[model samples]
Target chain A: MLDTILSFFKKKESSKDVAKERLKLVLIHDRSNVSPQFLEMVKGEIIKVIQNYMEIDEESLDIQLTKTNSEDGERMVPALVANIPIKGMKNAGR
Target chain B: MGEVIVITSGKGGVGKTTTTANLGTGLAVQGKKVVLIDTDIGLRNLDVVMGLENRIVYDLVDVIEGTCRLKQALIKDKRYEGLHLLPAPQTRDKNAVTPEQMLKLCDELKEEFDYILIDCPAGIEQGFKNAIAGADKAFVITTPEVSAVRDADRIIGLLEAHEIRKPRLIVNRVRADMVKRGDMMSIEDIIDILAIDLIGVVPDDENIIISTNRGEPAVIDGKSMAGQAYRNITNRLMGQDVPIMDLNVSEGLLSKMKKLLGFKTA
Candidate 1:
């Protein structure tokens, strides 16, 4: 009964899904010719600019190279998606 | 004027040569005059795959170097009166022919044949450039694997960069059983990633190996499923509107019996 319950709670992901996800991630970097260091630099710059206006949780900051529908929705294009947690905004006087 | 179509894959061993041989023969079977050129110099395989290796007297390098006339280098296939092959030089490398020479040669071939299918060397190198330089379009071939698909994407990008716009995709060696079990990538998954128009999807059939072993294309064998797939592709290439073959339809009683008996069904 315990094993059945445990199995029920575990999500089964198809290997093809895993392959698709991995291909999408790798192709994003390949198409843009962007390295991990380049992404790191971009993340640092973005954080610096955002930090000037608000306090952010650097530890929780997540940046990824991904794909999204183009403006016309005709095709998929490479996109840089970032999720940064905001602690608080800076004082207006400062 | 004949259309020069280059069959290419970014990675090796994805059946680029096989696809070329099959499609070339398929076109010839349709009564269109076709000539296949092997651009993979020093590693020529199209001739062997077509079962015409022993008949090669002159090669692409010989024609380009003016050592032999263009007509003298082309080996006509006795099986198909409309088909011929220009084998690559076994001793030379890809550097033997330049893009200009290839372009000129393609122009010369355009007057005689209805289709010129260039079996491209794998990878984005001088051989690839030479192969595509004279072509009007391209067909990027890949198997249903991550590495092949990734390399295919790279090849597509390179083809577009070289002004070969909107190259069609041929996803080869697909295993329908694995796809049904979610263990293999489907045609939809590959098309979703590549985002190119699909010309055809060839199922993984053991007949391809058997046919290659005999130095004949799977397309020549009417009983082979892969051969039927190539026939469909050939029709599509000729502006015919044949629907893609339904690979799942074969999973009937025979296959079920094979599965029950623990036998591998092609």
Candidate 2:
């Protein structure tokens, strides 16, 4: 049937996968007891500190709470991952 | 002493009362003396679900306030030999009974019954506190939906905070067909996220509604899939390692026919 042929070309990612990904992200923040506002405040402070040493792109800065394996790789732990794009380095002898 | 078990779900309408009714009845069916205490206070309905609404002469409030003896408030279910129900007062709110009172009541009931099942009200409030006050074990019920599971996670945190460690989870209203189609979350997916021991998974079935309408629990019906699921849960509660029921066996005829025609159902 045409439907069966079309199905072969369709995206394989199901909604349940999307739900799992979303739940993982939400639960990480929930378990870590960090609110979006709290993360934003922390980001602002980090930006302020980073600006003292280097020029960074605040618009494209990405910060989020995610899960990462622990040192022993036996447990998953909450991690604060941040991507701060450095534009330029500030003068050292200012 | 009898074990006090609290049935709780953070979200409303996730089958907490129904689970309580069926499990309590199922335990009695297995020759265990059981008592189900509805702790929803003003929104009490376990009595109706058990078909004991008209027999409630005295309620939990009466026993707590010393208006009646504990023995006077316990309603014996004629259908089940060892089953009894302590209905909540229809007129009173959650404040009518305190955690201390509930603890005392559970202590008294433990002396008489083999299993004391408390049906906890929804939300993390006074009702929830009172229901879990005397529970030696807790069963956290949840559906596959995101909101219900999120609330259940919060409840698990609260239960551990209250020293009710490692509360087992019961996932209700699971649709096997939906899970097969990758649309609904499966039991494994829910358990992975919640990170709790799975006690049981009940498929969504019309028999639950039919039994509720008749003021009788589905556990009494031999043919109902949900009833068989409850029987399995009861066996697990009694320390028997019963395997989880295979939900796919009850697939609808249309799906079976579709598969027969060589069509991809999922």
Candidate 3:
């Protein structure tokens, strides 16, 4: 698959490419350094935290540990972009 | 008393071995007594890359296990008089040697060699810890791709956590043509993503592949552009201001004169 992609555009499989590809995998694994089961457990715990207060809007709720790679700013942070539909009146929606 | 440099990348086959072999050779060629240690343990291959595979009888495990002394296991490079090799045992796994043992080995080596270059194993496993245990500084090798850049960033995080500051980036195997065609990520892109100081950039050369097979590092031949790049990196290590080669720009008369006259690249 990587070879296909390498051939697709242009092959920049140089040292820079080596570093770039390696960093991607490293970042993902470095976050937990554990198995997928552990990640699932963490995800479930996070969902439970949100579920304790109110019902989750499954479709709109997203809890992800995202990595942002900017020129000057690169970070690994958990993003909780969720929308919980409250069971209150229309005026109660802030 | 010189420095111990660990050349590492969390991803495998990203030229950690190649960088170690080349940089070690370059340092030795510049008259520095250097020892290149392969800390990969069972999957030992740095010796093969350095053309010292045939001479490895007492491996790293042997040195650690008290089967042989450190000096006895050190394989003197036949090509470069000042260069030495401490081959990893192909028989034993990483557990056979602990990071403390590796640290002791490097500390013992410090008195003899000017530079101790470690070819670190891939992944942040016990092997990686063993590789970086006694290093004074590190060079994180990476290629220009999303995955490699991400891995480099993670490795940088690990290094920082361990307090190994200023791990310079060595961008290897860069293809100038694709970069020019806007197909591949530019050096600027990789550096921007990693946000690290660039130490050197090596162009992807068929000669490196050929040299690996030949067991003769092309860095020995200054004619090869990749060799020149490695030499320049080593010179930079030695506090020389050797310029990075212009792999993309044509070495036309003007550029050649400018490079010769030590022009600061744009």
lDDT of 2 by residue, B55-143 (tens): 99999999999999988899999999999999998899789999999999899889989999999999999999999999999999999
Tens-digit lDDT track for model 1 on A1-94?
9656755643487888878877987787787662357788889999999988999999999998887986756457678899999999999516
Position B155, candidate 1: lDDT: 88
Q: Candidate 1 chain B: worst 10 consecutive residues by lDDT? A: B257-266
Off by over 4 Å in 1: A1-11, A34-94, B249-266
Provide DockQ values for all models, in the order shown. 0.45, 0.41, 0.19
Model 3 error, position B1 (Å):
1.0
Q: List the residue pairs that clash in candidate 2.
A: none
For all candidates in order, the CA lDDT equals 0.88, 0.88, 0.78
TM-score of each: 0.79, 0.78, 0.74
Q: Which ten residues in a row have the lowest lDDT in candidate 2 chain A?
A: A2-11
**What's model 3's lDDT at B162?**
81
The residue-level lDDT of candidate 2 at B155 comes to 90
Q: In terms of DockQ, which candidate is stronger, 2 or 3?
A: 2
Q: lDDT at A77 for candidate 3?
A: 34
Give the top-scoring candidate (DockQ).
1
* Pairs with backbone N, CA or C atoms under 3 Å apart (clashes), candidate 1: none
Whole-model lDDT, candidate 2?
Answer: 0.88
lDDT tens digits, residues B168-216, model 3?
Answer: 8888888878776555676666765677777788998888998899898
